[model samples]
Target: MSPLRLVIRLTAVAAVAVLVAACGGAQDPDVARVATGLLDAVDSGDGAGACALLAPPVRTELEDTSGSPCAEAVLEEDVGAPSDTTEVEVFDTMARAVVGSETLFLSRFDGRWLVVAAACDPVAGKPYDCAVGMP
Candidate 1:
């Protein structure tokens, strides 16, 4: 191929790569950070802090089910304390994070990531079963 043609082709390839990378082609640091932060808060027994990390609906659900405020109800759940994040998958505003043996779901709201579900376990041929959030 001519030198100019080769240059144009290379530039096009580079542009495509940039686009793919920007479109969640790899694990996002922000997503992982939020997931780990939530686990850390839970592990530390920081009920109020943990509740703050939760999405609004999840917090409300916990309060309604337990008939207690979110800060107190969140502590009653059996969400595990995973030391390290194993993986994070992000799709647009939604994300799934695997931390040790637990799987948590998150959503981007108000320019921040919030935990939508936690303490989730997979069920064969069905959706995940979570201690928090919709089941």
Candidate 2:
């Protein structure tokens, strides 16, 4: 009704939208599958398998940062095991999987979901800080 009330209403709607966007699940099942597969490989110490799940940019960063093949470098990261995955949020081509105490970020390319970052922690009002693929 009033200008101030209109502004407040708009802000409330925006906040709800953001929350809904951040907490989705299952509708993007491929994202969850790829994310879980990666953590499974890491949990089993299958370095090559883990590497296979990484997005191209992440793979390149791993190789470039470690001066070794991504297959080997992926093993060196300290991402936690996959006890459970929840809060599988998908925003267009990007997705995030909350795996135990960490989060994994994924990207889609040509219909494939690939891990772009793992062991990520969110900072309030800021981008995530990650142990892998942080650029």
Please tell me which predicted candidate would have the highest lDDT against the true structure: 1
- Name model 2 segments beyond 4 Å from true: 1-26
| lDDT at residue 131 of model 2 (Cα atoms) | 81
Estimate, for each residue in 1-135, the C-alpha lDDT of model 1 and write its tens digit. Answer: 999999999999999987887675347887788788888887788888999889998998998899999888888777888566468888878888888888989998898889999988899999998989952
Q: What is the lDDT of residue 33 in candidate 1?
A: 82
The lDDT values for all models are 0.85, 0.83
- Give the per-residue Cα lDDT of candidate 2 at 53: 92
Q: Which stretches of candidate 1 lie above 4 Å from their native place?
A: 1-25
Cα TM-score per model: 0.81, 0.75
* Window of ten residues with lowest summed lDDT in model 2: 18-27
Residue 21's lDDT within candidate 1 is 71
Residue 108's C-alpha lDDT in candidate 1? 85
